[model samples]
Target chain A: MIHINEQQVSLSGEHSIAELAEKFKPDSDIFIVNGYPADRLTTVSDGDRCVFIKKGETPAPEEFQAMLTARHTPGIQEKIRKARVAVLGLGGLGSAVAAALAKIGIGKMLLSDYDVVEPSNLNRQQYFTDQIGMLKTRALRENLLRMNPFLTLELIEEELTENSLPSFFHDVDVLVECFDSSQMKAATLRSVLTRMTKVSYIGSSGMAGYASNNSIVTKMLQPGIYMVGDDISEARPGQGLMAPRVGIAAHHQANQVLRLIVGEEERRRDEHTA
Target chain B: MNILLNGQEKECTDGSTVLELLASLKLTPESVVVEHNHEILQPEAYTAAELAENDQVEIIRFVGGG
Candidate 1:
């Protein structure tokens, strides 16, 4: 018996993936077994989960392997693949963080940004020259989809307001704060933390200039609030935001989100004892 | 009396409120979130909430840039 897309199929003997595809999805030319893309010549055994892919489809082999490698134990990859995250910005930090999360196989992401990509943003933001005139929400969604077509992105092309925050936070498990101004960041955090008390918040602060990479760190500000960055650096007239530092902080936020999704701390403790 | 503020022991006048603590620290009440003894204090309660000896306090402010 072989499991095809979680459904078991009784087989008389060992068969190639192509043979099974011919029997099951005869119209398809591609097959995936247990997450990796398998050619028809690859053999399928008992209990194998086989899936058919349409022609011209981009098989997310890298993403599949990433999910498998991310697992500390069985089913942990599914946990990461199912978790939903909301990112409230699409600038230097938000864009990179979203990309990293997509690569890590996050199931869904809700992106909120009202600005358009500017020529100045090319210095440090995750956008190309062609995307300069496009709305950040649209550009970011397009970019993320290109990287991982399986990632579900809910794009909100409006500034976050008191009434809108609740709606955006409705189903997401984690809220990522990536606003560029302090006032907006403060307001967003206050509104979300006070209203949506259960959602985890990961924010970036003080990622500016060419500061020492070690200065960028994650701080547990409160029970569900985690801040990443140096906590002191700021973009000034002379010293502006750079790509490297912003990317560092963005990854810090992304890494923390991954940890929260997979329960990395608890898993670490479990591993130490065993 | 001595109280732990963001994990550091700080001496404060007895019967001081959270507002007074913020004043001493020179932090704007609207710009920071305060937690007293692990319980987050609503912004409106800052003026009336008093700090006791040995009470732990955490004050966090938003920083700019993504």
Candidate 2:
């Protein structure tokens, strides 16, 4: 028996993906096995999972949505679609975090950044050359929408402060701290931890310079607070923040956000109890 | 009195406030966050918060890029 798009079928002999597509979906000329595209001649065995794509056809919006759901757990895509995440600061870390969360089908996102995109930001930030003069929040919104049109995004083009952070955190489920300055990060954490104790926060620190990737790590700072990156390295006049390391730290933050929304911690606790 | 500053032993003036310690280290109050004995010191409290001997202080500053 082989699974095709979550459905199982009994097979008598070895069959090529093409033959299976023809038998199961006569109109589809392309086949995908376990998320990877396969040629028609690719052979499949028992227990193989397959999905058929129509010939010469790009996935429609609905098809793309289906693909996302097929890749994740049964109800995770829907949970992500209903959750609201706020990314503060549209710099290297923030841009990557926002893009990652959006691609995973997060229902709503609040993007905040006061600065416009500069050419220097292209090194690590997720923005285009055409958006050089546009606000970072606006550019990020456009980029995310292009990937997931159904995403709901709220753009804030102002600097965040202690007084203003609460309003943004009002309805947000997760708050991502992506500020460039250490003082700002501390201020934001202080405000969020003190004022909005219920909201989850994922932050990055010490993600600078071309250091060993192993140095980057994610730690649960406290309940509802997760921090990623090394705690020692800092960007200085000579040493600068590079794309690879920044992307690593940003993805760590993004992953933590997803885990929180999916109740991964709770699942682990349940597993331990059992 | 001597205290641990970022893991290094440093001699601080007796009864020195966090702001004074930052000034002695040539670090601006706006650029660094101070944690006194594992508790993060708020910016407003830096001036009045006093330091005791053997206090474990951590000074953290942000990198401007990214």
Candidate closest to the true structure, highest DockQ = 1
- For model 2, how big is the CA root-mean-square deviation? 5.3
Best by lDDT: 2
For candidate 2, what is the DockQ?
0.33
TM-scores of the models, in the order given = 0.74, 0.77
DockQ of 1: 0.39
Which ranges in model 2 have alpha carbons more than 4 Å from their true place? A1-29, A33-62, A266-274, B1-14, B23-27, B32-41, B52-61
- In the range A221-251, model 1's lDDT, one tens digit per residue, is 5556688888778777877888899999999
DockQ (Cα-based) per candidate?
0.39, 0.33
Clashing pairs in 2: A182-B62
